[model samples]
Target: VQPVLEDLDPALEEAAQSLGGSDWTIFTKVILPLLTPALLAGLSLSFARSLGEFGAIIFIAGNQPMSTEITALLIFIRLEEYDYQAAAAIASVLLLAAFTMLAVTNWLQSRALRYTVKG
Candidate 1:
């Protein structure tokens, strides 16, 4: 996010200011639009990372059999119990969810990029 902010052309804000745009107007009409793609990318990446988070949670919050609601943890428990079929089913569900999220993010990114200048 910092890098993206720094990479933005100062001339955009300058031009907006010269055109009598207020600071808030310049931000909403100029900066936010430019930053939207990076914001979406950051959010989606963090969400994907959190979805796969298991080891840290297990280590910090110990496993309470059948009580945890986290899918990754649930799959781990099933695997430990030698219930391969159950683990596979749970894994398939997780995979489907992750793929769905990926698809949505891609769709949103494409839509956002539609108005972006190629240069």
Candidate 2:
């Protein structure tokens, strides 16, 4: 994240410069506003990825029930324990959460795009 932001800083500065006025003004007025979509998208993607993260989390989570266990790990544990219904419930919840987050991000991105186009 730091590296990506650092790389983007120069380009953002250049864009601000092209827009006219001082660097600070350009950064505050133009560059920051323009970065909103990218920032949100990055955040949403990272969150979704984290929610679905199983392998790495399971290794460190200890797989305790209702403790450090993530939804994915819970599902795996349920399956291993032969609790098919519990596994299915956990899977359904995970799917619903993922889909809801994705839908929200899509909606926000669409609204941002519309505003950008109108502006």
Candidate 3:
């Protein structure tokens, strides 16, 4: 992220200069606001991916019941134990969580769009 920001700084400076204004004013007034949505979207996607991650976490987690177990790993464990009810419950919870996150992301994107249009 730091490297990308460093690379972008030069381009952003060029853009602001092209607008015929001071660098500080252009950055604070224009670029910062415009970048908010992209930053939020990246964060939201990363968070969602982390929530669903199973394989990496499985090796690190102790897999104790209701302890270090993540929802996805819990589902796998339930399947192995032949506990369909518990597996289904955990799956439902995961589904709900994913949906909630998606909804929030959508809302944030919409808000960004509105800001871009109105600002």
Candidate 4:
């Protein structure tokens, strides 16, 4: 994210300033618009990572077999019990849901890029 913003041409902001645009205007009109793709990609990846976060959650929420736990943790519990069929079923469902969300986010990101003026 830092690299993406840093790599933008400083000349663009200078040009906007030369045209009487203020800092806010330069950011909203020039910088923010161009950062859309990176922002969306970041959000998409973060969401995907969050969906797979069993380890972190496990520290907070101790394992209780067949009881309340996130899907990822449940899948792990099933595996520990040698229940491959249950784990596989759970994993397949999770994958389908995650894939649907990612697909939608990517589609929206592509659509947004269509209206953006890229360099």
Q: Estimate, for each residue in 32-83, the C-alpha lDDT of model 1 and write its tens digit.
A: 8778889889988899899889888788777776665588888877889999
Model 1 spans with C-alpha error above 4 angstroms? 65-69
lDDT of 2: 0.72
Prediction 3 TM-score vs. true: 0.66
Clashes of each: 0, 0, 0, 0
Clash tally for model 4: 0
Q: Which candidate would rank higher by TM-score, 1 or 4?
A: 1
Model 4 has an lDDT value of: 0.84
Clashing pairs in 1: none
lDDT per residue (tens digit) for residues 1-119 in model 4: 67778888888889999999999999998888778788888988898888878877778767666565889888877899999999999999999998898888889888767756666
lDDT per residue as tens, model 2, 6-113: 545465567668778696797666556556577778988898788778888768767676788777777777899999999998888878888888898888877655
Better of 1 and 3 by TM-score: 1
Kindly give the stretch of ten consecutive residues in candidate 4 with the minimal lDDT sum: 59-68
By lDDT, rank the candidates, best first.
1, 4, 3, 2
Lowest summed lDDT across 10 adjacent residues in model 1 is found at 110-119
Of 3 and 4, the candidate ranking higher by TM-score: 4
lDDT of 2 at 43: 84
RMSD of 3: 4.8
Instruction: Quote model 2's TM-score.
Output: 0.66
lDDT of 3 by residue, 1-119 (tens): 34435544455567768879697797676666666677777888798888779878878876677788887887888999999999999889888887888798788877766644231
When 2 and 3 are scored with lDDT, the better candidate is 3
